[model samples]
Target: ATPSRPASGSASPARTSAKPARTSAAPEPARIPGPGYDSSADAQKQIEAALRAAKADGRAVLLDFGANWCGNCKAADKVFAQPQTAGILGASYHLVKIDIGGNSSANSALLRKYSPSGGTYTMPVLVVVSSSGTVRTDTHVTGNPSLTADGINAFLRKWAS
Candidate 1:
C-alpha cells in the first residue's frame, strides 16, 4: 500500500494568493546529508561481492534500489545508519545500494527479477535476498522522509538472516 500523509486541511476557498501558484503538483521531497548512490558503479559487480560476503558470513543481502536524488532513499539510509538499526543490519545483512536512475531503467532487469509478476515499483524499494540468493522480501521502506527507527527495526528483525 502507498503510504500517505494526512491532509493539511482543505484550502479556504475564498482566501487564495500564491504569487501565481507553484508549477509542480507534488511538494519537493526533503533531503538528508549522506553518501548518495554511485550511479556509475557496476551494480552487478557490487551485488556479486555483497552476495559472496553474505554467503561467507551467513547473512542476507539487502538490495536497496533507489536513486541519488531520492529523498526517501536518503531518509532510509539515515535510519539504517542509526546505531540500533545499524547493528541489526550489520550483523545480518550485506547491503547493496542499487541506483535506479531517473527513468528507473538503470537497474531495470534486476528490479524485474526481484519483483512479482507485473508488479509496479516505487522509489526506495528494498529487496531482501537470503545468502542462497533467494528473494525473501521485496518491499518499500516505511514512507517518504518520515521513515522511523522503530519501523525500520521491525523490518530488519523480520527479515534478518
Candidate 2:
C-alpha cells in the first residue's frame, strides 16, 4: 500500500533541516574560581579578600548569581571560561559566582547585605561592587552576557571610570 501525501493546504508533512557538522575547535574557555575554597563561609571569606584585593589593585568585584541549571548561567559559564574574558576581568575585577539554587537563605542573605534598595532578585544577575561595600552596577543581563561582552565591558569601563 502506498501512503498518499496530504491534500493541498491540509497540513503538510513535518520537515526538519539537517544541521551541518561543525569541526572548528572552540577557543579555550575562562576558568572561574574552582571548588577549592573550603566551605561557604570560606567562599565568603575569599569573596571579601577578593574585594580587598580589587580595591588594592584599583578594580571592582563582579558577582554573578546563577545556578547550574540556568541556560543563561550555562552560557555565562562558558564566558567565564574564556581566557580573554577571564584575564580582562581578573585584571580589573574580582569574579565571584554564587549558586543561588537551594538554600535560598544564603542567597537571600547575600542579596540583602549587598543588593541595593529596589533591586530585584533575579537569576543570572551581575553586580559590580566596590571595596568600600558599595554597589556600582546591578545590571541584569537576564540571559547570557557572553554574547554581549562589549556591552558588559562598556558598563564595566563606565563604572570603573
Candidate 3:
C-alpha cells in the first residue's frame, strides 16, 4: 500500500520570485519540492474505488503515474490545475495520481498492467481507463505531449469517455 497523501487535485505551479542577494556566508543547499503524491498508496485499491465511482457516474478513470521529484510531472500538474483542463477533468474523469518515488517502482504492477507499448515507462505517464475497467488510452505508447494548457485540455476532451 502506498502512503496516504494529498487529494489528487490539480496543484498550482510553484511561484518563483527574484532571488535574494547572496551574502558573504556560505550558500545553502537548494531544496526543491514537487507536488505531494502518495508514494505509499495502495494503487490497486484506489483504482478499484475510482472504477466503481466512475461506473456509477458515467465517467472515466485517469491514472497519473509519476514521482514527486519529476520536473515534467510537476509541469503537468500545473496544466491540470488550469481552469479549462480542470473543468473537463472534474466533469468526465476520476483523477488518481500515483507517485512512483525516486526508484520508479512504487506501483510496478499497475504500471505494467496499463503499459501499452512495453514494460518500461517514463515518468508522468497517463493511462485513461473506462468506467468498466477497460484501458482507453495509454500514454506509454502514445507519448505524453507538451505540458501546455491547450495540449492537456485537448487530450482530456478527446478521451473523456
Candidate 4:
C-alpha cells in the first residue's frame, strides 16, 4: 500500500527531515593602510614632484588634502583605492596625498595657492591639477560626505584621460 500523506495544507514529516545547510562566517572588510598623511612634510615640494611626474607621464596631478585622523578621509581613501577608481586614477594622474594638519592656518595658507578664492579647508578635498601645475578649478571636489563610489567614479571619468 502507498504511504499516507499529511493534510493538504500541512508540511509533511519527510519535508522537515532535512537539516539546514551550514553557512560560513562572512569575511571582514580589508583594512588597507593607504598613502600616509605626513604632517611635517613639505606640501608644496611634494606637489611639485607629483606635477613633474604627471608632466612626464602625460597625466594630471591629483592632490588629496586630508588628515590621518579624519574618518571621512580614510573612507575616501578606500573609495579611491577601489579597483575601478584606482585603475582610472592610476592611468590618468599622479597622486599626492597632503596632510592639512587638521585645517591649521599654516596649512590653509599653503593650500590657498591652489584655491585662492578660499573654502577648501575641508578634509579630503580633491584638487586636480594640470601637468603644468595649474589647478583645474572645475575639477576640484570637496566634502567626504559626497565621496561615494558613483560620485568618485564620475569625477575620475570626467578628469581622467
Return the top candidate by lDDT: 3
Candidate 3, 57-110: lDDT as tens digits: 778898898878888888998888776777777778888888776454548767
Runs with alpha carbons beyond 4 Å of true place in candidate 3? 1-34, 102-106
Model 1: lowest-lDDT 10 consecutive positions: 24-33
Candidate 1 residue runs with Cα over 4 Å from true position? 1-34, 103-106, 140-146
Cα shift from native, residue 68, model 3 (Å): 0.4
Q: After superposition, how far is residue 112 of candidate 1 from its true place, in Å?
A: 1.2
TM-score for each prediction?
A: 0.70, 0.63, 0.74, 0.68
Query: RMSD in angstroms, all models?
Result: 19.5, 16.1, 18.1, 13.3
Q: Where in model 4 is the C-alpha error above 4 Å?
A: 1-36, 102-106, 138-145
Model 2, clash count? Answer: 5
RMSD of 2: 16.1
- Per-residue CA lDDT of candidate 1, range 30-104, in tens? 122245677777778888988887777678888888888888887888898787877777777778888786554
> lDDT, candidate 1, residue 69?
85
Clash count, one per candidate: 0, 5, 6, 0
- By lDDT, rank the candidates, best first: 3, 1, 4, 2
User: Model-by-model lDDT, in order?
Assistant: 0.72, 0.60, 0.76, 0.68
**Sort order, TM-score high to low:** 3, 1, 4, 2
lDDT of 4 at 4: 35
Candidate 3 vs candidate 4: the lDDT winner is 3
For 1-161, candidate 4 gives per-residue lDDT tens digits of 23334453245544554433223332222222365587777787877777777677668887777788888788788888888877777777777777875656666665676666665456777778888877774333343335778888788777753
